[model samples]
Target chain A: MSEHIRIVLVNTTHPGNIGGVARAMKNMGLSDLCLVSPKLFPHPDADARASGATDVLESAQVVASIDEALADCELVFGTSARERHIPWPLVDPRELAAIAAPLKGKAKVAIMFGREDRGLTNEELQRCHHHVHIPAVESFSSLNIAAAVQVISYELRMAELADQAGEKPQWGTQWDIELAEQRELELMFEHLERTLVKIDFLDPDNPRQLMPRLRRLLQRAVPDKVEVNVLRGILKAVERKMESAEKNGNDHV
Target chain B: MSEHIRIVLVNTTHPGNIGGVARAMKNMGLSDLCLVSPKLFPHPDADARASGATDVLESAQVVASIDEALADCELVFGTSARERHIPWPLVDPRELAAIAAPLKGKAKVAIMFGREDRGLTNEELQRCHHHVHIPAVESFSSLNIAAAVQVISYELRMAELADQAGEKPQWGTQWDIELAEQRELELMFEHLERTLVKIDFLDPDNPRQLMPRLRRLLQRAVPDKVEVNVLRGILKAVERKMESAEKNGNDHV
Candidate 1:
């Protein structure tokens, strides 16, 4: 489960914060560290701050943007201390852990922390599916980026321990979400669209944006692997029925 | 409840960690910070790391020994990462929080963190009523002292919030061991051993060290309050029965 947890830091200005985050991740059994546009890298301060957890820094992925960091993550949460009037789904850190920690078995979970001073940009916040805040005295709520990472990492570790200790929030679906990785979902969608074209339900030349609309629908639906498999089965059965009908008509002619 | 909670760092070596502890404690609404014989203090690194939480440091109490640090704390818990061969009541951090957080209303609860290099020594751990361990990969389990404090503080805050949020929050329940305090258990053992001797079950001089064996057995048993009360009751009954048998010699008189 820890292997599937990724800690993403965006536009961090301090090198020591990167190290601090690595140390925190290792403490919490999290190994994946992703940095988006960090100002400093391979700096001595980071390694020094990492303590013995320098391996986390050494193996961390430095990406050009947030998208690259979160491409594989199905559940992405951004940390924000500001009370935005923008009306987003807001959760505190513990609540975030309760929802996100269990998903580690199902998909890659990314927890993104923004810059030291300003926090996550509104544009960056929009990319995350949920926002998490650390409860504090609002006047001195300026949690250091590393401290924020440490707080989230601590919750993640504690949540995992709780689940292991038998308080499992049952993921009892037959089409368990764990079976549907993002790449697998993409492949299943492609297969469905191709079958629709073969049966002329979707005319490749005169397709009035039907496939695109279907894509959007599927994206919103977020089907699990078993559901995706069931949809593909129906598409295959339609293609077989259409071919058999055409063959019988030719024989009669 | 937060006011009654104290975060203690024992024999700390790094100034930055002192600041880090303050920052993490303030993040979770915990303000009481106690440092026991720290190698350094009033360092710039700590102030820098504390960010806006300088108030926590300024008001921090510096003590000379662990005893002074925990003088007023009714419930004291020591955090350790290493697996110990000597048997002691062990609990995970969440369980520790669930049991200890509710006690803040009843008593001063202190969560003590050991040094960065060796963790709490055997003698130091003996002072704690219960031992808490944070789950981590055993290979690189050297969690910084500050990180340990942060993790426990996070759990403490979460558990308190859970109780206030109408979650019917459990106080460890199945995981909780309602053991008798050290002194109470000691008195019970003395009474039991004396009863055994009076009943001629255990000899006074050639007792062959049976009392020590009973002590080890009870330690491993970790009896809850009901079990402890039951054992004491049986011992008292045995002593009463022995006295009645002695009185039966009234026929000879």
Candidate 2:
């Protein structure tokens, strides 16, 4: 997971911030640092600010454009302080890390931060899959780029650490208490929809909004295999009971 | 609430950030600006960055030490991007607003940001009751000081707006559905302690530090009034059951 995580900085103005960025990344066990069109590289001020993270600076990869920096990356995330007028898939930093986790071995993930003065332009942000905003205090929402990087890196590191320990997840798979996998969850939803149709709970002709709401509710519960089985068992029992009652009534009549 | 907030900059070097700080504070409807031993002030760069917020600059309070800047403030919060050995009460910028909300009318609150290069020293951070770390990307966590101020101020403004809007709060106000006030929770805790003593679950002479542990547990829970009341009711029911059981046993004997 760590190996696939790439930190990309675009149009960085201050070499000191670049150096500080390197230090922040190194502290969090991430090494794939890429710079795009930095205004000043190898400045003395940046070297001074980098402290002991000189190795990160020395090994940094410089690219001319953001597209070039992220061309080979499977997932790209952009950090922005303000909401853009255009709509895009939005994820918090933690959620972004979770998305990145599964794709760790399969593809490289790039997290991009923009310049100090202007930040990532709308055109630049459009290249990324989603935008992650570090929710800040309403009174003061301007975050230093390096600080933003630290927060994102911390979330990534924590997510990676949690993945490594193989600890029983609060909502995911466990040996003794196995939860349904994503595929199973999807299948169950399909079965649920059919059952709802049979019971006339879902109007087959106009099942527009109900499915989304039900999906969200089920998603929140994150039903495990045991819970799902229990629910299905109850539904089956009810069906059998109704069938038995119908047979008895018909015989009596 | 606005009157009680003190925007503190510690060991600030650039005069521009000071002016920008003033500008950011004013933009967010905050005016209390405190500078702790700045390297330069009243510079042309600062005035230029301040824009029309010269009033905030002119009235800005200059202090020799952080202690002086925060002396009158009852609740102190420090901003840091890096983690330290000793853990203080860490809060995100949003969480800091919740912590500050209750003290709004009662006490002065100081939000301290450190030097641009080194950030805040651990010694300076000790004075803070809560340490707020802005979430950032791991690669470039170096946020500019003024930008940091802007973000923090924005959070405070949003929180205050929410408070004014009469929305159900997650952490502010005693009656908010999300969480009860700390004082009320503390009182409920005392009630639980008394009930425990009555039931002989707690020793009068030697409680063996149980109450402190219980307090810590409740603190961690951050129980709302509903949760607190539910727990209180359970305690009362248990006490009643225990009493009845003791009476029945005595009669049998």
Scored by TM against the true chain B, the candidates give 0.64, 0.66
Q: Which is the leading candidate under lDDT?
A: 1
Off by over 4 Å in 2: A1-3, A23-30, A79-86, A92-107, A115-123, A133-144, A147-253, B1-4, B13-31, B44-59, B65-68, B78-97, B101-107, B113-253
Candidate 2 accuracy as lDDT: 0.69
TM-score of chain A of 2: 0.64
lDDT of 1 by residue, B177-213 (tens): 3557887788888887776655455668887756665
**lDDT of each residue in B1-253, candidate 2, tens digit only:** 3777999999899897787677667766788999988899878868876766788899998899875786566567778787665333467666777667555665577899999888899767655656787655445565667766765675676677667765443234454334444445556767877866664456789976455434432443345456656555545554554455445555555
Candidate 1 clashes between residue pairs 3 or more apart in a chain or in different chains: none
**Model 1 error, position B137 (Å):** 1.8
Compute the lDDT of residue B89 as modeled in candidate 1. Answer: 86
TM-score of the first chain of model 1: 0.71
lDDT of each: 0.73, 0.69
The alpha-carbon lDDT assigned to residue A66 of candidate 2 equals 85
